[model samples]
Target: MKVVTTEIPATSAPPTLGVLLAGGLARRMGGGDKPMRSIGGRTILERVIARLSPQCSGLILNANGDPARFAAFGLQVVADDVPGFPGPLAGILAALDWTATNRPEIEWVLSAAGDCPFLPRDLVARLHEARARENAQLAVAASGDQSHPVIGLWRVDLREELRHALVVEDLRKIDRWTARYPLATVMWPTEPLDPFFNANTVEDIAEAERLAALDDAS
Candidate 1:
């Protein structure tokens, strides 16, 4: 796979719609939107938007309840069609459905967790490159030995199949769903900072600040 560090050329870019998955019921971090939590003096979602906006043709937020809370971000808020906060897969489904309807021209959707403030700048470019080279239906990001199923490229055309998995099969695990298809796992270096680091709890917020400094220096 080609190692990309931003500065992606238009020729190698994918026609992808970015979906920030903020639909999860953050049980580990109390109950509110985890992405709303501030790190490095900015909301996690804010940092995420800054990282992803340039890589995608468009961006959407998948969150339940009142959309007004995220109004400041100016992103289209898409609620899950599955109803009730099932999981991140529900958020991905909502995004895929929205993309199919609103962005008919786009063939791919790149899904990323909203609470992840340190997403790699080359996320979109690298995912598309690996997926195309491997002839895979899906592509996910990995760091260390752990695979982040949520941070991956999805096929817009598979929205129906995904809905079936979520609703009929009751499949909430991303790995289980992606396992049925050919997938490419792209790795990113962790020397400077793990690009996929996510703030999942109250304590993680402090760690994110330290990581933020490392990221800035790099």
Candidate 2:
């Protein structure tokens, strides 16, 4: 339960599985998968995958309800084991399950929300470094005043613990479940930019466009 700090450079490489949580109904955007929504002339999911793919050994989508919709993306799609669309935790569960059963060589599964197009380019590298430095089972990303639990690293061995939390404890909050085990959080400085900022709604999408423009300008 004690939190510590560590620094990870952008260049470090690590073995990881990148999993994007795209199962949300996106009621805020009128009931479609939010990742499929477009911004900056590309689907948000595409931008996310482009950013994460470089840092991970493999990638998959943790989605439910319908798998066929994401067929063109050409990534393994997994559903929640415990039904009723719990939250991102289910996605993490599916990622862990996939890594444990199919891709046993992967040591960690890096999770991020599908709508977060500005995800840190070094996300997996930093989280893995922090996890090693803290000797923790998981590591989360934080920026300035907020903690982004969805952006994290999950050890392959934590699958059983997560299954218990979802089925028996009924705990849905990601941080709450992470609290039961050792965790390390790496704070991303907000000076240059806030990497965890996400496009959650129409307004956020506009803001992302402005930010993207600024990024291109500079």
Candidate 3:
């Protein structure tokens, strides 16, 4: 475990890399990349990249098979080190590894699902405030009555703990690993827009379109 601290300006310096987890099997959506699904005349992944690119130092995509599909996005494509479709934790680990190796100056990684195109623009800022104020090793975002464990800022030093949890402890749930560290949750009001809204099912895509239309009207 290595810990490297660097100056990460809340408004300027790059503190972390934005890792988009897109490796899901997507059985719920008929086995295609959820991020590639269209919403409001643009792919959900494109929208997500647009929103996330400015939040962190750089971006990476965690997806399996034919990395070329995402190559057009111009990001490094990483796959899970652990075999079998374990879940987002595997993607988190891959992101952590990328951070530890390439971005040694940074100490954290910000993760979010590719389908969450409307994620808050101030996500990194809010998470940094929560992590610093609480002295937490991890800070996850929550909105309304929902807690998004996958949408979080993770300390790069905890990479080993996460690996152990996934491999030996058999901890498949994100909350389970987050519980072991000093963690904090940043709550966001759902008013105006629920920043964490995701396009999981067909109905969700339609609702996103409707929401986009309503947003434009205002």
Weakest 10 consecutive residues of candidate 2 by summed lDDT: 1-10
Which scores higher on lDDT, 1 or 2?
A: 1
Task: List, residue by residue over 120-191, the lDDT tens digit for candidate 3.
Answer: 878998898888889888999999999999999988888998999899987788998898889999999887
Local accuracy of candidate 1 as per-residue lDDT tens digits, 124-186: 999999998999999999999899999999999998999999999999899999999999999
- How do the residues 148-187 of candidate 2 rate in per-residue lDDT, one tens digit apiece? 9988988888899899999899999998998888999999
lDDT winner among the candidates? 1
The order of the candidates by TM-score, greatest first, is 1, 3, 2
User: Given candidate 2, what's the lDDT at residue 217?
Assistant: 54
lDDT for predicted candidate 3 compared with the true structure: 0.84
Off by over 4 Å in 1: 1-11
Give the C-alpha miss distance for residue 147 in model 1, angstroms: 0.2
lDDT against the true structure, each candidate: 0.88, 0.81, 0.84
